[model samples]
Target chain A: MERKSSDRKARAPSGAAVQKIELTEALYRALFFEWAEHGFSALSLERVAARAGAGKAAIYRRWPGKLQFADEAVNALGLKMAAFGDKGSLEADIRAFHRRLRIVFRHPVVRKILPDIYAEAARSDEMKAISDRVAQTRRDEAKKVIDRAISRGELPEAIDRDIALDFLPSSIYWRMVVIKSSLSEAQLRLHAQGTTAALKSLW
Target chain B: MERKSSDRKARAPSGAAVQKIELTEALYRALFFEWAEHGFSALSLERVAARAGAGKAAIYRRWPGKLQFADEAVNALGLKMAAFGDKGSLEADIRAFHRRLRIVFRHPVVRKILPDIYAEAARSDEMKAISDRVAQTRRDEAKKVIDRAISRGELPEAIDRDIALDFLPSSIYWRMVVIKSSLSEAQLRLHAQGTTAALKSLW
Candidate 1:
């Protein structure tokens, strides 16, 4: 019964609509899950193609290989977080950033895929180049907030902006890597509180 | 000529002296280098046997498996770091800890195996138990220094000790995971400075 209904709808959709629906569906399936069953190493061409219901040739045609697929996955993470700052209160901006980070950390794709990509990149020179780009993208995203604070004179002009930017994200990653603890909503709030207090002192 | 000379010495040595030499050689090999090479994975019967020049049976006689081997490795790290928390100043004590950590981070075992273990533990429930214990031990080591400060009354009773302790190690691990950078001597000094300032503010 389910197969009959699916086939009927699949045939009823126009070609462009079907293509759009399939693309959307494939991307959603690819990015939506815990990915715990098979972490990064399992994200081979075969597995991605099978999961996305696209041919291996189709996937390869778009992304050269695993590294490119991983890059696309990272680009997808940009969807999970929102830009913050310009709230006129540094504390509020930091709090929003932390809250958004908490949501991103809880995201299955980010949590499972990110560390694996990091580990793989550490080992493989090829992957490391792509991963470096991913890191820069994230840093630029972060700099937007920190730069806004500096323009508002909430931060010191002499402050090493690169080093200062390292604070919050470093704390979050440390908990993930060393402590192996999930970032709890309350813990994220505590970190935001501590970071806000520390940043205020920096000025 | 070198091999022949060593062969003559091997023949001339008495049984008791040969035993002493064997034990000494084993102990010498067990130091920082061995641990640095294999990491926790190297603790497997086959790898440890190959790396340490012992039979798998002999390794099994000593340690049941990798976890037991890891426990011994961790104990050595504790003993090596035991002489910390001195120099009669809070800044000095924190600086000392970072210096020791710098040495540890440079170890090959720490570089190769630690990230793999962290990644594995994040995905595996079984490994999580061991990983958690290792984390707690490191935290305990950090807390001991904090406890000493409290007794000295240098740190105020009102300080949130856990938050206070989080800064230095978190900063270092952050560099490793996110920045993909090694901790340089200058970076360690900067961490010490930041931590010292943070602790002082709490008082």
Candidate 2:
């Protein structure tokens, strides 16, 4: 039995590797809950490992320190840009985008995590850079949607893309996070229509 | 000398009242710096009094507790709406408003205090409500700008006023606080133009 165990350790079985991946994911999940509740400044790695029901060595082996852990855990949450598809018309594309935004912002985890992240970003320059990168990535993806609309002759070539890119997310975030308004679906639809109308004129 | 002092106190002298007011203002000022640097959760009334060279009892007399002190100190900072003074066209009025916004946001106290306030707001529902009230007050003031433009025939009366009121500040806050981007005068001018153009179309 000892010889067989030694052989397995030497072979590094796929089962062990899969188990390690699961452990890492569990650690990240625990970290998210901890962060959402306590924020970055108050977070403890020991608490995270304990909450994850994993050993401290497991966390240390994955991340060198707290900041990297925070960055990775937040990145793992995956706030990627939504694929609105080719909605054909600019208004339709924007409405689809808004619909996706409403869903994303309304997610239980996203709602809790976002405010904490924003608060963390406000306090730390490193976190701010990470947030800016995330925003830029989303902006780049949104630019594609606008580009498609422009190619379809739905938008003017001279449309100020930079300002337009900032508008949608900014407005949604302002309403959802800052104002903490409980926007009904109809209200969200009206916002989408109003924004689309404004974009059409500007573009 | 004690009799003379007692007689003076009985008279309720204006000079004594002025000195007391000065001390109260000084304490609030110190509290602002402390809150800005350390944040609300970490703020200490003792430290504020010490910084202001005032008595702890004085602070206690003015505010029942740290939260009220923080609220009153922040409110006293006066983020009042800018008086754009009817710049004739919507674009010009927006430009003046933008200029004032730039100054207010760039103020050292505002720059530091705003992030801390946001961080606190994320943590506390009370802070969130205070922030919302401040935003609503500013929005009410901003509505007058649009009302004036509508009256002047510069913007259409049919415009969705609610969304437009949210747009300017949301965009500015997104750029300044979330993205942490520095805006040049030229960029501000472009933003002002884009927003005005959008409003024109929406209205």
Candidate 3:
């Protein structure tokens, strides 16, 4: 059976697998950037094709339209576990989260893409879907930290876990967007550390 | 002094002052929202003229262009003191700040204008200049609170005052824009209390 199987030829790789593969991350980044810069109203197939050094038909083959392409690009930049810390303490976890947050917040893509996505989300279901998918994981990870504190009796029994999770991130973002300050390393650490302490009673 | 005042009045308000005198707060708010929504791309003499219920000639007579109008609106909406309280302790004072912040944060103008201003600031030097003017007072006020805490030994001398200020508001804004979760009264108190406790050691 092994000999026969080894001799047998396999089928060619499917289009979905091929679609998932990119020749370079740069190409992926270029596509994400163009979409973020222009948004749905201004984004065009020709422009993305030009930026990525690919033919319009190539992108069309992988994505049905600009919306689908956006989904794929955002997925490539999705949040991850390493983004937050879990060193058996809430303070450590929050510090890790802010470090990751500062990186993301300072990224040109986030500055360009986030506002447009937010504005468009108010009007477009497709964009809203993409926004929710991208944000869900980070929020969930934050909530998990709160839950762990509660489980370990590190926080008070009556604390509201969800609200506690939101405290640090919300403060950072409000300053970034509304106040438009240059975010320093010290600022990030203070926000993380201070918020962790403030909300610990809830655990 | 009376003669000086009469002479100054006889000279009439300067061009800018005359414009300010003519503009009502509601009209100012409407102009601000319109400019924020459209940027320079969508703004025009006719639109603001219509929104303000004035003729095109009236707005042109005052602002000269959308940019000038935008400049005035930016200055008009700068951070307001939402009342202050001497609550007899650092925790109470911090809590008062959060209460004021909640009011400031929830204003439709603040919410709508900020993200747009941030996005524009990245691209437009003029907007950047105007946004900085708007943001400075808020930063100063926040710093004042930290200074008060340090004086009372509520926070450690080693605490970086600037770092302490950014913690709560930044986190709150992040939750507002990214999560679309309303910052409730309960959340504000929780964040305020938690962050103050964390920084208590530094006091």
What tens-digit string does per-residue lDDT give for candidate 2 at A1-203? 12333565679846564236677789989988776565556677899999999889887767778887777766776776566578877767776777777777776566656755655566667877767655665676568778887898877898877666766567777777665566677666656665665556554
CAPRI accuracy category, model 1:
incorrect
* Ranking of predictions according to TM-score: 2, 3, 1
TM-score of each: 0.69, 0.75, 0.74
A144-189 per-residue lDDT for model 1 (tens digits):
7677777888777776554556665666666654454676666565
DockQ of each: 0.21, 0.29, 0.29
- For B95-198, candidate 3 gives per-residue lDDT tens digits of 77777766776776666566555666655677778767766666666677777877887766777765576664565555564555687777777666766776
lDDT of 2 by residue, B58-144 (tens): 888666788777776667777765565788888787777777777777766676566556555766777776666556656765687
Please tell me what DockQ candidate 2 reaches.
0.29
lDDT agreement with native, every candidate: 0.58, 0.69, 0.64
* Superposition TM-score, candidate 2 onto the true structure: 0.75
Could you tell me how far off, in angstroms, the CA of residue A147 lies in candidate 2 after the best superposition? 2.5
lDDT of 3 by residue, A1-203 (tens): 12222233234333323333453355567776775564444567788777878777767666667787777777777533244546687777777776766666776667666666665554467978987877676677777777777777777777876667667466666556545566777667667666677776444
Question: How does model 2 fare in lDDT?
Answer: 0.69
Chain A agreement with the truth for model 2, given as TM-score:
0.80
Q: List the residue pairs that clash in candidate 1.
A: B36-B109
